[model samples]
Target: KIKNWLSAPDSSRNMNEAYGKLQDGTCSWFFEGEQFSTWKEEPSFLWVKGKGKFLLVSLSSIIHNVDLAKQDSSLSMAYFFFDGRDSQTELQLHHKLIRSLIWQLSYREDHKVPLPLVNLYKKYGHQQPLDRVLRDRSFRWIALQIEELKKCASKNEIQKKLGKLPRGLDETYQRILKGIDRDYWDDTKIFLQFLAFSKRPLKVDELAEVITVDLGSEEGPAFIEDKQYQDPRIVLTRCSSLFLLLYLLNKTSGIIKLSHFSVKEYLLSPMLTKELFMSDAAFTNWVQLWNIDLNIWDQKRSRDKTDVMKMASALYYASLAGIKPTVELLLTNKAEVNAQGGWWGNALQAASAECHRDIVELLLVNKADVNAQGGDYGNALQAASFHGHRDIVELLLQNKAEVNAQGGYHGNALQAASARGYKYNVELLLINEAAVNAEGGYHGNALQAASAEGHRDIVELLLQNKAEVNAQGGEYGNALQAASFHGHRDIVELLLQNKAEVNAQGGEYQNALQAASAGGHRNIVELLLQNKAEVNAQGGYYGNALQAASTGGHRDIVELLLQNKAEVNAQGGYYGNALKAASHWGHRDIVELLLQNKADVNAQGGEYGNALQAASFHGHRDIVELLLVNKAEVNAQGGEYGNALQAASAEGHMDIMELLQEKDAINEDHKEEFSTE
Candidate 1:
């Protein structure tokens, strides 16, 4: 279920359709040619350049040979052949290709699906039906999951097989239609009509349910549930070769689509059009029966004509749904295609964000602004790149989108792409002259964003593009500190290799060493120490690495810092010193270790002047006793509460107050004896 729901259905039928007609040894010329030999020998993409209808047929032979050769070996192979005859299928051609490849490569000896795919399924599967799970957003999400896969060679070249004249196609389709049982004529016609004009592919269950809707009933259109087929699979038998079942993994019934555009053309022919119920009128009836508004899917359309935002929302939503006709209708009615107020700002950004490549092109052609800045991503390019929509990103770039236009949560397209780990988008943006080190956003710059997000490949790419590794300004300051704070040890090493300054200070944790210590990442701490990070560097909330570690109760880290000769009495942060931080935080073990390392018992400099006062104010009696035993002044003056006695009294710690009083009394008696002497 996980694999099937998450991956594209296998393209075996498409491959078989191409392979079945080939003569066994016909493609030997290409295999023996230099192009094939070079591609096989090197680990690079093979572009079989040519200009003819026979090119695809020959390529199919090569794919089959490669598949057979790679089987049962360490090498794995996946292939997709694009057919552009059907405009509807072509809308999702890239999706089908990517999904098919993902499914093919996911197979393993243990038969376990990859964790990322499983997680994607868990997130989007139960929230919607299986047919609805492969929408634009989720498709982009899964594509980004394995964008690092080997490059695939593709062509928009038409195949001669599907380009046959209408006469031959009409006869082949007509015979299949005539062979259907007379009893199944009405249902079969409705099925064929649905496939011929549906917005997207329909699942068997959905089509079966749609067939039960009585649009011409005396009572307004309603689903006659009793009219539904007992078994949805029966629809396949009714249509035969005219339709194809795209079965997903682990499922019996699957999506139903036309076998070819020729079948659609035959169905919509002058002679069969009326019989198959294929017409704009039939689609209108469907729209009415399904309760869908033709102009917009949104129910919150503006009641008042003057409300521009609400009026513009219709166009935005129409674009978002990838309903080209609705978008056209709204645009024809003077809808604001460049209106800037929605989750995605405008029609162009919404379309771009959702991977609606055609709609994006439509809007751009309709004069939609390419660089109008607003909303979550600021502009279309950033939104497209952030969501891993490479086609849309390229479209936006080609339309003159400012690659360095900064304003969104991610600041610019490069940072947005980098943060999301969309390396392909990042590469595309870099190639288009995006400022790799351009600053201003949540993660400061592209390198910091990639590093903070643990996208090593993106980090490497940014570095190769000359990204500043030690550049500061985000939540984690620089790339190295971000990686360290996030416990990304490998990224930390990479940043170091790029000459990231180990002691560069400026974020919430000041330096990588302090950030690592505060995060309790011992391995990163060791790495930083090896790179000569200043152990006693002071400037963040916790003063130094030792204080930060102590405050976090990271005893192991504190011990490591002490062994590294960290100043036990280093003072300059909130809790004054390491002992004061540990005592106030109730880390008795760390306090003991700090004291043993000779941390000044009476060091005064932070919110709590001394360790005793800090422990007393917090009512950590065990820590208080430990501090007292270490000879911390019982009446130490100066701190938030003035002294240990007053600090304990203010917090209403009776046991601590009494202990402090007794210690004070002992000191007083000693003072009197000394005065008498």
Candidate 2:
């Protein structure tokens, strides 16, 4: 059902089709709330009877607009403020906000006043310590306090600064911190958000290196290089602010499985995460799930500088250590696994194809859809097979991968293994009974593959197991054709013993014998002949085995045919005779052999006329003279010797023309003109 929906034409539908929770049109379980009895229909509200929390459930895209995200911020007291942060000015702004919040608390009546706010007022005096203020409130308040602290200029000038600070949470946090006088968020969220970004994980050396930024003293790094800098900490803290949060929530790679194009659109429209975090079971669940954004499967998102910077950071850690929380931090649960149109697909497919085992494993363990179609790459199995990572294949298979999954220039694991001659992988697929004749590339099945590569052991294994004896596919007809085409005599013999079709037709040539003869494989031809393979099978556009042998230059086989009571003057093919083909290819030895076999000399060849004409076309003047000596008619049209003088002059064969002219039997009127007309 998920596959059918994911591969559907409806782009406007919700793309979170890959998630198991979404199995019933919607997955409405949450953490921090009570558990439900069972799956329910589209209920408007969920009552967590134990937790005293009323969960509102809605089905929508997780991605929300940043402009619209402002709505979520409305509930926070310290919402992002548009102002500049200076010591004296921030003091003024803080004093004013303090007065307003204090007035609201003193009234004890402002519905806008939150319970946490009233509680904070009762706990902390009217002038709460700056350190205590930052620690007690939500991130929203911290952001507001940072801004209030950074009101560096007069009210008139604050807007100018806001105009210059850029329009995101990082800048918003930056503005707030510019004048912060209180404590920062707890050190744990700090370490988790920022240190995890570096993937350094607060090593002793790093923890030892601290830099400070004075709230009033925005000097160079040297001002407090040794001290744990407030500014740097703020930088780290603000890195996970709303803008950072959204960026983190939205940054998906090919491995991530996108649930929707817009994070807030897919996640919040339905209040999905709120529900997930509402229930302990949903949050604690360790199930593997894929995010499928079928709605925007083909949409391309232009990555901004932040995206690149984030990716660089992710890749850096990936190269040195391995993918940790970086993939999770950058991409959301709603990000697509097979995200096609970003900078790249989720990180796993890229890493796996490049043989980055660690990343592949990381992604797999993190619930990255192992079977998702990767960007430009077909799927994870294709990647593993192409790289011949036997272990990766094992991992994907363990994850329930489709064995014959098609992808790459040649589709599926079987074809890739066959092409690369990975005998063990071939055996794995064969033992597992992979699609026997799954056509991808020229070698479709394991039999043709083993035979083409002369894997005699593999061929014997496949044949004994009833693998297709003649699975005609791709360029070669089947196992017999591939072996005979490449002249694998041993493999050919084994196939025939297994009842392999001898007269099996193949690419550009009708049968295995024809292919062998065309390639001048004398041993293969002899073996096929011993099996009583057709000597005159005329199924190809190029005609029979005799013609294939003659054109490609095989003298021993030509004699063998004659000795075996083979017809020497079998006139078939575009090229009329065997001798014509031999002379056309300048096989003087073969031509002589054919002549000794009483072959027809005046037979026309493919685009080369008869034997003497074919010889003249190839500039074999010595052979031409030989043909003339054999009572070849000088005026035989289409033969190179037809007009002996004309043929000689065309090739500048002055000596041959002189010899021909010296013979009174040769007419001087036979001009040595090169003109075909």
Q: Pick the candidate with the highest lDDT.
A: 1
lDDT of 2 by residue, 269-353 (tens): 3343353233222211111111111222133434221111122223323322344444554344434334443222445556665
Query: What TM-score goes with each of the models?
Result: 0.55, 0.47
Model 1 — which ten-residue stretch has the worst lDDT? Answer: 303-312
Candidate no. 2 TM-score: 0.47
Compose the digit string of candidate 1's lDDT tens values, residues 1-677. Answer: 86556546445434433553576456755654436644644648777765223666777666654642122335567776654322355325677677778876765534577788788878886765666453324333233223312222333222332353223444555655777898988888777777777655666766776576676767555445567677877778777743464643236656667755556666778897667774876655544433422232222423322121132365775676688887786688676678766667888988898799989988989999899988778889988988788989988889999999988778899998998788999999999999998998878999998887678889988899999888989767888888887668889999898899999989878899998887777889999999999999999777799998997678889999999999998878766788887787677888889888888888887776788887787778888888788888777678776777767766677788777777762334234421211
List candidate 2 segments past 4 Å from native. 1-350, 363-379, 431-433, 572-576, 638-677
lDDT of 2: 0.50
Error of 1 at 185 (Å): 43
Error of 1 at 405 (Å): 1.3
lDDT of each: 0.73, 0.50
Best by TM-score: 1
Per-residue lDDT, model 2, residue 313, is 25
